[model samples]
Target: MTDTAVIELVEHAPAIGRPLPDAVGRALAASRIVDAAPDPYTAGQWVLRAGSKVGAVTLNVPDCAPVTVRIVPKVPIARLFFLLGYSLDSRGWRDEQVEVAEHRDLLPALAQAAERQIDRALRQGLLQGYRDAEETSLVVRGRIREAEQIRRHFGATLPVEIAYDEFTTDIPENRILRATVERLLRLPGVARDVRRRLLHQRARLADITPLVPGQALPEWHPTRLNSRYHQALHLARVVLTDSSPEHAAGALRIDGFLFNMNKLFEDFVTTALCEAYRGTDHSCRLQDPHHLDEARTIRMKPDFVLYGPDRCPHAVVDAKYKKEKPDGYPDADLYQMLAYCTALGLPEGHLVYAKGNAPHTAHQVRHAGTIIHQHALDLDQAPDGLLGEIRSLAHVIAADPPV
Candidate 1:
């Protein structure tokens, strides 16, 4: 009882407080995590379920040490669309085409196409009625009404007579008549007087929304809109329900509209890059495939190839509209630029991403005494900041001794 000594040993898991790996975090940030939960005892570790896929992450924590922890992201197919240019808005499928294909989910794209087809059919029906009236002078007559008429027969014989009349047959005249007659009948206007009863009847049959004056039919119209909508919907349904390449191609055309968003982004970046590097003795060449003599084939089309001061290869940059860096290292991008560098005999290249809040990164991989540098340009930053970063890069290139 006099001398009692106790030594307590505390064992703790590795610093579970450490943030998740960069790749996992990026994927999670871009995706929708379905079920994210952690054990109370092992708060650092988490089991995450995301869109038909599941994954786990164990944070690294030191013995009994409190450290900042970042949740790991789950990998799932749903994240694919976020990686692409599609985004969510209040409207149902704001950028449906891009979002569907970005996720590589053909079903939604096909469904959208099918819906478009239905709309197309409706539009076509409307326009066809107009065309029929114009071409054949076939006015649509509403239900004829029968009125009792007295006729002289053996006595006063009662006969049923119907009222009907004809009007001008020109397409424009018919269109006006139809529109006015329909409008008047709907509102019971003075234009529906008995004097013009027959004309009104004819107009009612041919009534349609008149085409705007001097305005040619729009690519999208009442008829075309409904018809194309339905056609697109049908085609989409066929595509989604089938695995045939034909169906896939049709779905891909719908997907093309999505890439248009990226095209717009690319154009903006291209313009920015051009403006920043103006007066630098650089020429911007687009889609010029550099031939790799050894490979005996066209290597790639660098989006923009800038010839620097003294006619040196200044920079080779390719614009990517992806929301997140794929595979963390931008390897695909690096590889693409490397091919350009090798074919152009340049020492370095640049990979410009449309989004990022961080400062630009310069990566150099030495090969045969030539340093192939891959630089990242974050276009989301202020224009001046971006311009400054670009200018700094230009200076760096100028100072580096050609390897």
Candidate 2:
């Protein structure tokens, strides 16, 4: 078919006013709609065009009626070459119709698809890792094993065992190992097993050195570690130092260990939000702290701020990893959300938390004649349920006429 006819088939096959040619109709019958057209096409409209055609085309949408196309004679069929070439090269369009095959550089698209798959797998792995950490209590068990092993191995060679009534504990295996490795590298009389294990652990955790045949493992020449370990160490140090009562109670206190939890919560919230509003013209802004100069204080950084179609601030959402009470009265959280609403000039803010501690609740508080609504979201439900709650909240915000 001519390029114009082919273009028309693709363009008008999705519309209500147009009829597709017989060949285009066959393509439509075979095509699977990946993305549905919003606002224009009626329900049951076929948005994809695929399969083989025999000259003319017929198109139909279930409630909107159908149209027929007459094949134009002496058409160049150059469009066929483009379609065939694209279909041969593309990945996402593998199962799609030849006519609807999206032609673009395969490398970038493949890379993107691979990246998305990897990210999804990573998220799944992280979640499973947390669960495994909790369930297996691996760190405590591993520490105990290391201590026992050290006591057994070094009890005779070195004075590393701390004696007890019927049992003995190693001189805190990790510290002893660190000290022994430091000393052995200086001298030469270190146990090979001890040095080997320590080196292995360090390499696994710190990317210390490359292991190759016949080359002696390098001594513990410690420099600053990679960004990942450095970040972990920094957070750990903060948590260790700031464990005092005052720091715990302070509003802006940064609990370094909680940073990882914060990141996980952010990921969960972003995923939940995107799933909830899959096709909507809305986007989520994360970890952005909005300042209100009038208040003369830095307001709480919301976990997420959702924007509406017109680029206006729509709603603020905070995802709390902790559980809330059955009455849904998290006073501090409410106050924080109020601050966000005031600063953002939004009508509502959400506080989403893990469920089972409380039933869902909503509150409307009038502040300076503006009604600010507070909502309790239950994370214990399915992801789709969480998304539904977000969609409902967005609608609630939209339905409220300007205050």
Candidate 3:
């Protein structure tokens, strides 16, 4: 293998086709950054990140510059790393099972967020251990062979299969979590302290098998009080099952993970708004379901619905990943917001979009005293600023009437 195959080019927050990393390998084997063709010998596509996102970029033959390689994520996808961290942190770090020294120096991005999460989860899982080491029947060197030997014993090797209970970290869930942590441990860029913690965690979980993808997510509960485990279980579930951390490369098996910006935007908005409305008259919901007719042939699902004290929709809101066009707002979005307001018999609806140069505007429908308001949130802003917008939006929604 060549240097290009062995070493992946590191790109830091570059725009698509704007800032290109040095071209090292032959045409297509250079860097993973996506760009225009005949330009440089780089990977087929670029690892373009607008915010804190990490994923594999899939490409067509046309997108390839005669030879394009794939990039991979060692742990979970880049998207979840920060959000998970923020979620855990927002709860006053109550989710932490073990004391993790803050990593102020580490890039608060993809690798750090994931390593911190996995390291803590694995450590906590070990401290509390599985609910029950469920008696596993195994053939090993032991004191006694409880079950009858199925085959004739070889010279001094009569260890028959026997069922026994033990407190071991070598379980399926631990194995999966262990493998993910080990993968991050092997990555070259992990910080010194973070890497130290991960190495220790890997040693702790050394006995667990490195399970492959598609294994069942084992069940776990927080039976112990001193150590919190729901967080650990959540972290394990994320690395094991989230959509962004998927493999697009087959034989080469390079990490090609992707986070859908549209979905991420919607989820973030819904979550922030939900958090703000806690202990209020309105309860925020995401993807609330609805039936269109008596037979239920048609279904209407809105992104966020503000349910009032009566448990009926007081107002409805939709999140859009794109900006308002310089010419006008998207007609389809307006129609959809109107339908939600009418269905719920509310006078107001809202459309939230990524911040653009356009000023915020509101549209008054022709009849039924219905109106739709539009607001734009800057995605690049700090999390507090973005959540502040959601808080403001929640206040507006609360002032609306139901039916």
Candidate 4:
């Protein structure tokens, strides 16, 4: 096995085992982006298989030089960005804004894009907005908490507990920007220039309270006042979602940014479907929860459930993004969708998948009398065609007869 600092693999690459240094193999085995297993046919060889995650990560092995593992996605990089942006905000996202024609790697491209947007957001200076605050004040303010004063102060009049809204730059929007900048700085592969610019943004937002790592982010609403910050905030959320500094394999440290294609595809599909139903009488819920059994213990959540004007489930659909095998579509997915249809008391269910070897197909369960339809959405086409496919699916779903 040759010693190298980098290893490149494609998502769902063929299962051809390759030789690797023991330390590298161990480190790869510990990462979540791929599965590393010992090769049964070849001695001292290991197979690294990429799953739904795509991006680069640096694995630190004990006594060995750091190795960076880059998993390339099946879809084109530009399309991947489209999926991400559309998922963030379907109506506001403009793929032209995210320029990635020069970049091939996910981390550097993401870092560059994030830095540019953050810079644009801070160009006019930090945005100021009203934030609700609560504290004990010596002088009376907006409103006094009478119950708190009686319980904590025992009716004392010296200090009063008050709640008020104050206009300030230290709001959720700025804090999110700062936290995202900090996160980008920690990850490897960021261009030096981009890193420097992110630092500047952080300094501009230094006064804002930094979000605590691993805690829920502070809430912010969309309005005319904070319109300029919308684009930047959306990118910040994409960077922070499913990213953490705590990923570790015992003593070996793993630090990098990754996006789960499974989640991205699901979000884009469900959100697009919801958008298609915007003005229609039907309503859609993403991840609608239900129970499969009489006791209500076997809980299941379908990717999407369309509700009609009667406020009852009209259709059920699930999104799947996996490499299709030559044999046919996976039976397990059909089974799961069947379960969803049964639980929702619907006569039919739908399963959407990324384009694969198998085209759209349907299955009829014998005796169970349930029909499950499988649809494929080709992601390689232009955004208009991609969304057009979703619109067609929406029409079919809405027109389906209910049980």
Of candidate 2, the 10-residue stretch with the lowest lDDT total is 126-135
Give the CA lDDT, 0 to 100, for residue 33 in model 2. Answer: 18
Model 2 segments more than 4 A misplaced: 1-263, 295-299, 323-330, 366-376, 381-403
Each model's lDDT comes to 0.39, 0.39, 0.55, 0.86
TM per candidate: 0.34, 0.34, 0.65, 0.89
Query: Relative to the unseen true structure, what is the C-alpha lDDT of residue 350 in candidate 3, on a scale of 0 to 100?
Result: 88
Which candidate, 3 or 4, has the higher lDDT?
A: 4
Question: Which portions of model 3 show Cα errors greater than 4 Å?
Answer: 5-84, 87-90, 93-108, 117-125, 130-166, 171-173, 183-200, 222-238, 248-252, 324-330, 357-359, 379-383
lDDT tens per residue, model 2, 1-403: 2122222233112233333443334334433211123224443333443111212322333332333332221112323222222222222222222221232322122222222222332232211101111111222332233365465665343323332222111112222222222322222122344346435433322321223322332222213422212222221222222121112222222111111223334455555564555577877677776786677575556777877777777777776644443356656776777778788887666766544323467667754443444455554454346557767765664455422
TM-score, candidate 1, is 0.34
Query: Can you write out model 1's per-residue Cα lDDT over 25-67, one digit (the tens) per residue?
Result: 3333333322334434553444433222111111212222211
Ranking by TM-score: 4, 3, 1, 2
lDDT of 3 by residue, 1-403 (tens): 2222222322222334323332322222322333233334444433332322334332222222222223332222332344444443444333233232343212223345556556555553564343333232445533344344444344234445444455565655566567667655544345677778778777877777676565665554444542443455455444455543334343322233434445656766777778888888677778998765669776889998888888988888898866444356557788888878777778899888866623489989885678899888765555567567778878887887666
Clashes of each: 44, 13, 14, 0
lDDT of 4 by residue, 1-403 (tens): 5353777888877755767778778667755557898898888898888877888888777778777778888888888999999988899999988888678888888988888888888898889988889889998889998999999899999699999999999989999999999989887778888889888888888898988877888888999988888988999988887754336657888888888888889999999999999998998898888999999999999999999999999999999886345466657788899999988999999999998824699889999989999898999899999999999999998888997
After best superposition, candidate 1 residue 51: deviation in angstroms?
A: 14
Best by lDDT: 4
Candidate 4 residue 202 C-alpha distance from true site, Å: 2.2
